[model samples]
Target: MVRKAVLPVAGWGTRFLPATKAMPKEMFPIIDKPVIQFIVEECLEAGIENIIFVTGRHKRPIEHHFDINTDLEKHLEHAGKTEILRNIFHISRIINPIYIRQKEQLGLGHAVLVAEPVVGNEPFVVALGDVIVKDEKNVVERMIEVYQRFGKSVIAVFEVSPKEVSQYGIVSCRHIERDIYILDDLVEKPHPDEAPSNLAIVGRYLFTPTIFEKLKVTPPGKGGELQLTDAMRLVLEEEAIYAIKIKAKVYDTGTPLGYIRTLVEFALQREDLKEPLLDFLKDLLSRDIPQIHRT
Candidate 1:
């Protein structure tokens, strides 16, 4: 069983700018819950028993978010807020949360490599803190299903437009089954013309222990930092690596636009917030703007 999962949450989140200056990006709330909490809930739903968070400096808030807050629980209990208290307790009960400091703002591969000792000799899952997968069947759960069948490394991929392939790690694959492909090659952020395929890797990955060895020898690419795509390519040379085209609505919450989109999407789903939010948006859209006539 893939009992352990690694969550790399150490990025500096430079894109979010001033807002992230004092707060970790993962702590940014989607609505009522922080973004990282969604990722944690997905892992827990996928039967992940141990969550090893590869965090860095200024990520103490992420750690505290998952830890037990007895004082807060007591206060909530005294205030007769049982619903909120139950939710708080549920956060601490879901899984075993472990924290490991990355110590540097290295690339994704470096972040995963830092958790090697904790994930020793186990087939594990790596989830990016900023990616939110919204699907009836959790993305990680589907990837685990694929892993169980193939007994090899499985990566979550989605088809991107030819123009957008340069923004993601593109994979060359041969069809093996419905939505499953044998990953023959991986190229990180290649030009559209140079890209072998439009299938791009997303944030979720299931890997065998062999990947740690590959990560150790894999040289840094692009921005002089080790890339997870590079390590996975090395693994591809020796073992069979498969890619699954995810059937999910994926939201990249790392950037401002993506964050706003996810926030609104999530808000629109809640009964308490949906009507009010929709009405506010409708009112804003209905207001006419004063036109400036040009000579």
Candidate 2:
């Protein structure tokens, strides 16, 4: 069983600037719940026992969110807000997260590397805090199953358009079975024509402890940061790595535009907002959208 899971959320969200200046991007709400909470809940549902969070400065809110607040709990109890109290109490009490501070905003591979002291030799899951799948358990649970079957690290991949390959880490692989592949090579942000295949590695991964050794020796590549793709390719040199194509909509809330779209889409999925939101969209589209020009 995969007992531990790691989440890295230390990057400075420059793309979501002014708002993220104070608040962590992962704390942004999808309807009523925060994005990171959704991912943590998904991990817990997949039977993940200990969740290790690789965080940085200005991320205290993330820690406090999962910490107990006896005053608030007592107030809620007295106010008779039973349902709301149960929900929050579950988060602070049940999902006890272990936090490790990454003093530097190095890179994704570096962030995962910093959690090695807690992870030890066990195979663990690394989930990017900003990425959210509609049903992440569908991916995490399946990754756990594949890890057990192959005893190799498993990465979640999904088909991206050839033109969109440069935005993600592209993988070269050999077909093994339904929605599974034996990764042959990995390239970080390759151009469309140079991409090996349309399959792009997303933000979720199940990695063996050996990956830490690979990451340690991985030299900084694109953007002068240790890319996880670069380290995974090193892992491929020693042991086979598997890729599973997840069939779910991946919401990348890394940029302002993506965040706005996710907010709207998530709202549209709610019963209270579905019909009303559709009407609002229809009415807005019927009017003229004036384009603003720089003076």
Candidate 3:
């Protein structure tokens, strides 16, 4: 059973700039809740037990967000606000959160490698802090189901436009069933013509402990940092690797554009905010602002 999951939240959000200067990108709010909260909720729904967070310096806010605030709880209780108190306390009750500091900003592979001591020799899941999968069936749950059934490493993949193949780690695979593929190869950020396939690896993964051995030997490519795709390639030589084409809408909240899009999409789904947000959007769109377009 995959009881442990790793979340790498040590990245300095250079894309979000001034906003992320003081705030960790993972703590940026989608609407009312921070982005990491959604990922943690998904992990809880998927029955993940120990959530190992690979954080870094200036990430104390992430720890505090999950910690119990007794003073606030007392104040809410004294003011007779039970609902708000329940929501605040529920954060800490979700799962057993473990914090591990990634002393350097190496890369995804290095982040996962840092959790090796806690992970020991067990199969686990890695969910990127900046990605959120929204669907009826939780994305991590589906990946776990595949991992349990096949007894192999499973990665969540999604199709992207050919033009955008260079922006992701593309995979080459043979179809086994509906939305399932037996991975044959992986290429990181290949040009359109050089890509093996259009299927790009997303942010979720179910990896066996053997991956640590591969990651240890995996050399840095492009950037002077370890790449998870390279480590997975080494694993593929010895064990079977499978890919599941995700059936959910995945929001990559690492970039400014992606963050804004996710925020708007999530806000529009809220019952209370839907009407007001829609009206506000319509009002903004209805205005005749030719100068904005030219600029």
Clashing residue pair totals per candidate (backbone < 3 A): 0, 0, 0
**Which candidate tops TM-score?**
3
lDDT of each residue in 150-209, candidate 2, tens digit only: 999999998898899999988899999898999899888898999999998888899999
Superposed model 1: Cα runs more than 4 Å off:
289-295
**How far off is residue 135 in model 1, in Å?**
0.9
How many angstroms is residue 113 displaced in model 2 relative to the true structure, after the best TM-score fit?
Answer: 0.6
Task: Assess candidate 1 and give its lDDT.
Answer: 0.91
Question: What is the C-alpha local distance difference test score of candidate 2?
Answer: 0.89
Q: Considering every candidate listed, which one attains the maximal lDDT?
A: 3
Error of 1 at 64 (Å): 0.7
TM-scores for the candidates: 0.95, 0.95, 0.96
Q: Tens digits of per-residue lDDT for model 1 on 199-280?
A: 8888899999999999999998768888898899889889999888986888999999999999999889999999999999
Model 3: per-residue Cα lDDT over 1-295, one tens digit each: 9999999999988898887888999999998789999898898889996899999987889999998889999999999999989998987877799999999999999999999999999999999999998877788999998998999999999989999999899999999998789999999999999999999888899999989999999999768999999999999999999999986888999988999999999999999999999999888777897754532
